[model samples]
Target: MADSQLALFSALISLLRRLGKLDDNIVLAYTLERGKKLSMLSLFYVSNVILALFALSGMNIPMYNAMRRCVPIASLLLGPCIYPQRTTSSIIMAIILITAGTITAAQGDLDFDFKSYTFGSLSVLTQALYLLTLQRMGSDNKLGSYKTSSAKTLTILYVNSVNCLPIVFAVVFLSGEYNSMKSYPHWSEPGFLFALGVVTSFACVFSYSIFLCTTVNSALTTACVGVIKSALTTIIGMYTFGGVAATPLLIIGQLINLSGGSLYTYEKYRLQKPASPKPTKKNSSIRPRKPKFTKTARNSSKTTF
Candidate 1:
């Protein structure tokens, strides 16, 4: 049901573009202009999503979130390749803390699975690559003509969405899921339609936010945002969801993860803030002495004359 819905959603976007309704999605033309330099971005994105879905199957909600907590670290490691930015000691420590938290939480998982962890790790690496590529494109001097961050993000989202169509279809076809819904016969059901629409809408919104944030901020910062959100989701899952052990360790772990992400965000903001110009020394005020009422300075010249 879900796979078929995804295929249908992709088809809808492609159809809109084919009808020239989505003039904003110039990814295909842009890709052509770039001589296919950006062809790998779609591949990386598709791999990232697919690996994430694979990871989700082997783990519960809390564990799933915990597994993805390492994305920030992955982004950091991969970031320098796209943009060589220096990392601060605080950021390094934060990454370590987040990794520790993830490990701690994973140890307490009630449904630990090696295959899930492996897939999640692959997803993290792929996501890091995708993010860095997208960020580089957004920050490219070639794209500096974009009027605003929103415009740049929109171009990225449109291109990525359109490019993802073929990849999504290929995956579905290979998995034999394109016809899965035919067997289930749930396509016309009201509940199925509603759920599909809701999921697809949220996914679109999520993709927009991802590109926008990644464009406005650094890839690492966007990854940190995800870590922070997932940390909250993990905390909520502990009590509400039966997938987790709900142990004190999990609480501590999420706290550490959350704090780490927050610290990274603060550090990034501080670094990006323009430094205040140093206060220049004010010129010493040299007030002229009031002319003496009985000035004697000219006496020598008058006497000489």
Candidate 2:
């Protein structure tokens, strides 16, 4: 673990210098200070990926998706313990609905295996932890005076990629995949390399799209898009993966699951947004009294009033 962390830190410095896109000093300082947190974050990330692979391999696409959709429920249950946020009734109801959908979907899973279900559930839990860690770690870490949201988002992407690399490489080597890849005859083929490059390029674009979305809109919008995208994927999975029986129960359950997830995101946003300071009765009542001053202040700042 120590070696992994050290390697990650070294790679981080190299990337920051090579890319010349992030503030190296700020990123390195944060990486060094929060070493333990990042290590734990990586653990969750690696675990989630491994478990998700197992879940995906063992389960059908639709069931796998349904199980993974429970991440929000896990987040709702676990988030307040760490960050102490307000949890509303609507949030709880949303979780309940999501849970019911998962259960209903499970009932319709003709090829269900307990191991796959368990692994999928575990993947969702670890993924929730990973996401929570990112939120907490990113939110608290200051990137100095010149930091923008885009910079912060890029910082996360860089740090995460670097931090996870050592462990990922270690896993691949230890699991014998490295050796297997080296022996694969077609790995050196141009078509294979071109396909790999195209996939890698798309992945980079996807990451940038996410960050750009945040810059163009807000985190809430990005998250809402994510929820909608998941729903679309689930729907597509049902059709694309012919093995999955499009039974009425399965369809209804997936719909319910998607609806619940969607509703949760929308409600979560609405509930949280209301917490921000708005014009209160007192502020409104005092507005007329300070009308001249308010007008002057607004004009001088030329900002939202």
lDDT tens readout by residue for model 2, 1-305: 22333344456556666687545444443465444546776688778877887787788776676676667667767777653445568767766777777777778778989888888889988877766666665565543332555655555555555667767778778877778778989977999887766666566657556555644443333433455566567678878875677778777777787677677777766865856577665554554554456776768886555
Candidate 2 Cα lDDT to native = 0.65
lDDT of 1 by residue, 95-205 (tens): 888988998887777677899889989988998898888888877735325656776776666556656766777777887766774587887799988997888777776
Clash totals in order: 0, 0
Top TM-score: which candidate number?
A: 1
> TM-score, each model?
0.81, 0.72
> Alpha-carbon error at 249 in model 2, in Å?
1.6
Stretches of candidate 1 exceeding 4 Å from the true structure: 1-35, 141-145, 239-241, 274-305
| CA lDDT scores, all candidates in order | 0.76, 0.65
Superposition error at 117 for model 2 (Å): 1.7
